[model samples]
Target: MSLGTRPAANAAERADNGAMVLPGRSHLRAQRAVKIGSLAFLILALSAATLLLGRYTVTIPDFFHIVAGADIPGASFIVMENRIPRVLIGILVGGAFGAAGAVFQTMLRNPLASPDIIGISYGASASAVFAIAFLGASGLALSGFAMAGALAVALAIYVISRRGSVAGYRLILVGIGFSAVLQAVVSFLLTRTDINVATDALAWLNGSLNSSNWDRVTVLSMALAVLAPAVVVLSRPLRGLELGDDAAAGLGVNVERSRLALIVTGVLLAAVATAAAGPVAFIAFLSGPIARRLLGGYRPLGTAALVGMVIVLAGDFAGANLIPGVSLPVGVITGVLGAPFLLWLLATANRSGQGG
Candidate 1:
């Protein structure tokens, strides 16, 4: 048995022999359950409010009436055409980013290893911007190009980092370097583009939900439908791999194969979110850490996904309504919020001597 469980076993054995046992273990599990349940409820409640709290203001009655096929004129159009698709897409993108971030962080055993920070999102952004500025790509074509770029970047980083074995810090360093280069490329492309194309590209790079619609929703939905299940199935191997390479190998996990699967899966999830929502700022980076804290550092993927959904939807709401006659992109709010968090993380890491 592991060091962590040995004491628990002793305590339980003593309790079985009529001695008093510590209650912290069960209490901790119960507390985690409560936290997870509470966060899930909060996400659902926020999503409902998102659908109802826009300028048009669909009342609860109206929302239910529309859901039940009553078709209440303007309310129905707003709900069906605008608000529903936006909210659904937000949830999908948030969940994808959140889950992908969690997987990356857990697999790498480093909180700073999320796709957004590690150049994957920048890869997608650069490719999308190039497609827009040079090839006049739009819609699904842009998304496909984005995914291809993300995958290529991720593969290149992996190849560079693998010197016998892929070290987490090595991967991160390579990713950061590539990310800066890609950003410069995007900027150069933007500067050379026509005004109208530049405007469209800039807005997309800012990562807004202004263009959310049914078609984008369908694409994200289809991606999640296939990839989410793969993630869930792979999570077991991931848990095994977390116990170190030798231990995972002892548990019959092919270490290199598992790592490759995880990398590909994570890249796809992050790429799809970037394609649909333009790299919605720090949702991927922030969501995993926040979810870990809330789940008491257990790496609860589902809870992380919910936290992501809440962040994006709530951030979108705040961006739109927090100021009069001014609307910010969802990414702007997240970037602003994430900067301080990143600083705090670095400060804490320094203090703890982790040097992340």
Candidate 2:
């Protein structure tokens, strides 16, 4: 073949390859959309069911009427004041935990970097336990203590891990160490406290929606309103950082600044959620990975949030009714569900020599 003909043929071949790649990309995007839509539908269905199906079942018509401001005797108070707040707080706190987990896992590029696995949740739990046992804090004051504790732990982790740049392995190691110490602190406090206070603290630590109320819902809503936007904005820099610090810097990202912002934002998200509903077990640790799997390894923060809501709402329902006579904490159900997955993940990682 002539040289000129060869060049034209190669150009045609490149065009054909590009055409093939476009369709694959488009197909993947369509699949992702479908998966995300399905997740949203599941969340809605779970929320509705949670509201309707319980010891005192409310009919659909009655639920709508109650929502429409009708006073339908017992149903009105049960649906409006009790069930509604529980559902709302579940959704809000679940989303917060999911988003926080996604940020930590993605930013650090480590699956074990979850707030609960590290010291953040332990921090919140320990602080709140201390407040309950000694200071006799309750309501908003207890929540405030939780938030402060999470932030303090996060700050300490950052300072300890920051040498030149924050290494993911170093951060995770430091956090795990902190987690052990804080867990010990929590246990000691529970032992030293009065039995009544210890019982209350234990319930909170187990993560229940039993105390869900309009006040808790409102606080969580306000915190997410401010923090969610920060997460969206920082996500761009987060993506860059995923490509490594030098590469992100080359891409015009302020690596240290962006990382710090992300850390603070993630800590606050996890903190508020823990404050509102306690550290509801593996929701944060599990949500991101679940969403990513559904999206074929593409992590969408929003999808993670929705998956979190579904897990919480569904878990809460099952926890309440799974045993005929006894209601369990939502965290207990989640812990049971998530433990197997965690073991599977560890096994898979070990087989691939990534468990270290």
Candidate 3:
């Protein structure tokens, strides 16, 4: 009787333990679901706000009407050529910057490691500016020249940094140094150019959505459609990297290879974004931290992208309305917002002894 009683008691306890684990698992899953929902909602709200709150007010009904029928005269041109494409470009460029920044910071385990910090944006900016200022390239031609210049610089950085395989910290440091040089080069280029060319180049460097059209949208959409899948496929390896290099290696991850792949992807993302939007200022640097805060300790890549989209669209909208007479550059607004945040981050990193 006693033996039978012991077996029954053990069985009941085991069942209770299993039941407890189920709730724990359920809690984690629910948390993730909420996070996803919140991020999705935020992006949707910002996108809708972009379409609705512009100077040329188009309500939800009109927006849908334009979408449904292309024959609607002014509505068709306004929807297809203006608001729709501008918003699309905003989302693409913002998401690319945010995602690239997140990937760099997470991979390096350094919050300061982003595409702009790495000189990738400067590379693209320099090329784009030189082409416009000196070569007199404009329109579609300038974009191609810009892309080419950006890629060339990225390749140079990769080659220079790969001393016995590029370490994350080393690559970042090298990139910053390289970017400093590029900035000087940019300054010299602008100084040498004629006033008109210089003025035009400055505007391009500053960035704006005023020039966004269907063509810009088409180019960026293609890049995102391709890169988004690559990022998703690599998410597992990226997550594993957070567990420290040795642990990730123990789990059969090729740490160095993964790091290189991610860096290349990040460079491409930043390069493409810079070419399109002239490296819209704080979206890359601010997005990761903001997303992390919103998602409550989860490193939020998708959420960060959403936040970037919101930031760009909102900043551009505010720029349109802020001064009335002059259309402020999107980069100018983002710079003002991000500069303070960057200062705060530097201070925090120092306090934490993160060795940025």
Candidate 4:
């Protein structure tokens, strides 16, 4: 009788503990849901503002009418040709950068492992500049060169860092070195080009959305449609990978294969986005950390994507309208915003003894 009662009491205690724990878990889930919803709402609000509150002031009714195919002349041309493409490309590019950055940071277990910091963006920039100055490449051809550059740099970094396994710090150090060299190459190319060509290349290097078009929108949309799903599928293995290679292998993950896939996917994501937007300055670096903070240190890729979209849209809006008579490039605005954040991150890392 005593033994039976003791077993029953143990079961009751276990149930009570579970019941006590569940509420906290439920509360955290609820909070994350709220944060995600808030981010979605913010994106919508920004999109609406970008569309409706520009130089021409598109009314809500006119906006709906334009969407419904009611051709309103000036409004239609501006909305359809300029504003809509810019918003669409910004969202797609930002989401791609954010997802890529989160994957790198999470997979490598290092905040400094963003594509931009590690020479991938510089690689694309250098290639695009070379294409412009020497190959006379433009449009899709320029984009292709940029993509090839990012992939090549990523492969080189991986190969150099892969001694036994790629350590995050070693890869980051190698990438930084590559970035310096590529940056110098870009500078040399710009100096050697004709003044007119240099002017055009400089504009692109600054990452403006003034030339956003439907073609860019279509290409980026298609790329993301394919890559986003792949990222989603690989995210499970990515989470396992965060637990270290041996541990992930213990859990039946093909550590090397999974890591390779992730690197390629992340590189491609950053590549496509750079191809579309000229490496829009720090969207990749900033999105992951921002999302992690918002979600209480839990890194959800979707949330990071949303955060990236917000950053780009907001930056573009500010750049276009902030100085009244002068329009700044989106990259300029983002760089200004990101520089302080970068400094803060480095300082915090140093204080925490993670600076190395």
Cα lDDT tens digits for candidate 2, 1-356: 99879989999999999999999999999999888899889889989888999899999998898898899989999998899999999999889999999999888887778899889999999999999999999999999999999999999999999999998889999999999999999999999989999999999999989899999988889989999999998888878877878888999999999999999999999999999989899998999989888988789789889888889999999999999989999999999988898888888889998843
Worst 10 residues of 2 by lDDT: 347-356
lDDT (0 to 1) per candidate: 0.90, 0.92, 0.81, 0.92
lDDT of 4 by residue, 196-249 (tens): 999989999998788899999999899999999999988889878888888888
Model 1, residue pairs in steric clash: none
RMSD for all candidates, in order, please. Answer: 4.5, 1.2, 2.8, 1.3
Q: Tens-digit lDDT track for model 1 on 268-322?
A: 9999999999999989899989988887778778888988998999888889888
Better-scoring candidate (TM-score), 3 or 4: 4
Which lDDT tens digits does candidate 3 get at residues 1-356?
58769989999999999999999988977987787687667667767776766556777787888788746666667777877777788888888888988888888777778877778888888988889887899877887777777677777877888887666778778888988999999999999999999998898889788788888888888888888888877766887787778888899999888977887787777777877878688788888888777656678578777777778877887787788677797899999999999999999888987787
Q: What TM-score, computed on C-alpha atoms, does each candidate reach?
A: 0.92, 0.97, 0.89, 0.97
How do the candidates rank by lDDT, highest first?
4, 2, 1, 3
For model 1, the stretches where C-alpha displacement exceeds 4 angstroms are 1-13, 16-23
Error of 1 at 34 (Å): 1.3
Is 1 or 3 the stronger prediction by lDDT?
A: 1
